[model samples]
Target: MPLSVVDLYRDVLPRTNCKDCGFPTCLAFASMVVSEKLPLKNCPHIDPETAARCQKELDAQHAAGKWTRRDMAEDALQWAREKAASMALTDLPERIGGRLHGDGPDRELHLPYFSEFIRIGAGGIRKENGEPLNRWEQVFVYNHMAQGGRTNPTGNWKAFQEIPNTVSKVKSMRAHVEAPLAERFGGKAETLGRAAMRLGGRDLTNESRAADAVWRFTPLPRVPVMLLFWDRADEFDAKVTLLFDETVTDHLDIESILFLSERLTQLLCEDGTG
Candidate 1:
């Protein structure tokens, strides 16, 4: 069967936009691989065996037949939209910790995300500043779709593996989210604070006082993420620990968690701190 861009990517790609692979993003690199524009050896992170396996799969598929998986992104978004449109907006606050706005036909669900509120309407969504949120709407939609029971951020922080059923993702999550974050801003320790502030993160160190620098960010309601940064030392290299509320999966799927983590890394690196 023909492999999709994401399928081939999931096997060998780190899914981080580290740029060592020459393409700007691993996604783009995967595309280039699919198009025969770049070889797997260009990416250093992929082990020799994984690259060889991917190459064999590519060759076999190319010589025989190709298959495509169902378009998960579009289908999931449509399903989420339908689900949100059918539900009563009045129950949003209790279910997912978002307040309802307006009344009757004008009613919409308002959920806090960083410094902005993602407004969900029947048609789609908009940013707090009233800009069309084509990309962000999917997250809000998925948040609503996966949202079940409500839970608090427990103040206690844990790694992805510490969460249930997420142990398999520890290596990829560290490669894609944790290690890249440390590599990006671990040197410019001072500027990361401003970048975190841009994402509505506040220094929560005074409350817990465990990390050298601790910041709390709520990318979505009920999805509180804690980022702990430790500067490099003579004995220890720089480090970053990204923690999540245990109840995170209650509001977003594992894919969304990865997406949000990658997004945070992108935001941190955007200030050219790397």
Candidate 2:
């Protein structure tokens, strides 16, 4: 049978977001393995025998042109593109929280993505500078457009686990999104706050909670995310919790939501890495 990214992620990988494989999550690493041909051994957690077997399977599939490269992401991207293409361009702004511009085949929806604006149109998604988005970015924005959700964000927030149909993804949320932030900005609440603000996040520490720091971000116009960080106090370890507006699912599926959080974490950690 052909090797697929999902197979590698669900069956072979540890699904722990250990970062031992130099990727943010097991899912991202799995995509790299199946799509970009990253070595399976890059993941130190895999046993020698299992790694060898999986490599053999992957190599055989590659030779036979049977490897399913980025199966889920590519499929979602295609579906989003077709869906967006089918929708009336003029109606996208009201539905997705963007502004419509131009006319006819050149029409585009300009939407806020984090601190930047992206133009989505017949040419697909691109940054304000006109650089094209990567596959994951495209998948996220395209999926948002395809959803055509018109509900406004309710100011109320909910944890990822509290969201409907999210049980299977809770571990992923911790491993990939919340855990990484806790690990990176654990005792550094001020640093974390600054990093977040650089990306247009607002400090909301005074509103509620005994957290060391609290911030909110509007990565997508309709999806507002709240991040709470508990600094490493005496006799306690640091913690990070992400809360989302109740209306998040109306605009994005669980997978895309996770990706959005992961992207925020990536941006927050960039300054430290430099």
Candidate 3:
């Protein structure tokens, strides 16, 4: 038989008045534990033995309820359909005029240039020469692209121009677009890097410059994804790179990506996929 919350508490929670889990009482923590909202590790009072036992129990529950990659893919496809219906687009377009032409490609069609960098503890953003960026600085350099709400100044300005637009849209409607998905599941949106679309009337195969924009997403916490986007010098072809955090890569199978992609694509397309 499985251990009930009562059994776990009676055998585990130290009945003391220790306000460790931010709860006024151990019983309150117990409630949270039963709901699986608070892990036993938060108690601070549990010894290693008890913590291990609780962890084992929770792990079992997670293994049983966890979703697979196929499940995510199905959910993502459904989400995409709904998004397409709302966006008034029967099928996603390739490009619109000089800009990207897709309705909600970011949700499903992985863009070419996306990447991730883990910032553990405090660190300064610096230029290539090791000069630290100012405290008021709005942009940080990552993979030859500038991130945050600032304009690029170098000759590479075209590489990061579209970021502001995407950030603005995401920020304006994050709750309406992202909250519901997160509530139903668990993940976060993050800005990983930037990219550029080919610009000018010249044939892309001969163009040297491209239009650029930032990349962002809601990812599972601690399970980061790497994205890479680049076009050939002629701008005729594009490429995408996806790097999964080794720690959680096994958890991020194709299905989860599909599900997340669908949800995001739907939200971005129709104005509300939350």
Clashes of each: 3, 0, 18
Model 3 C-alpha lDDT per residue in residues 103-218, reported as the tens digit of each score: 45322221121121222111333333445433212121111111111221222121111333334334333344333333322211211121111100112222433222123232
TM per candidate comes to 0.68, 0.74, 0.28
Candidate 3 lowest-lDDT run of ten: 192-201
| Local accuracy of candidate 1 as per-residue lDDT tens digits, 1-274 | 4556888678668887899988899888888776663577788999999887777777676555354234566776677666556556677678777788887777777888777788766646777776766553475455554464567667677777788877677787889888987877766777888888878998987787777789899877777899988877787878888998877877777766776787777767785443
The true-versus-predicted C-alpha distance at residue 146 of model 3, in Å, is: 36
TM-score leaderboard ranking? 2, 1, 3
For all candidates in order, the CA lDDT equals 0.74, 0.85, 0.36
TM accuracy, model 3? 0.28
lDDT of 2: 0.85
The list of candidate 1 runs beyond 4 A from truth reads 1-72, 82-85, 134-137, 271-274
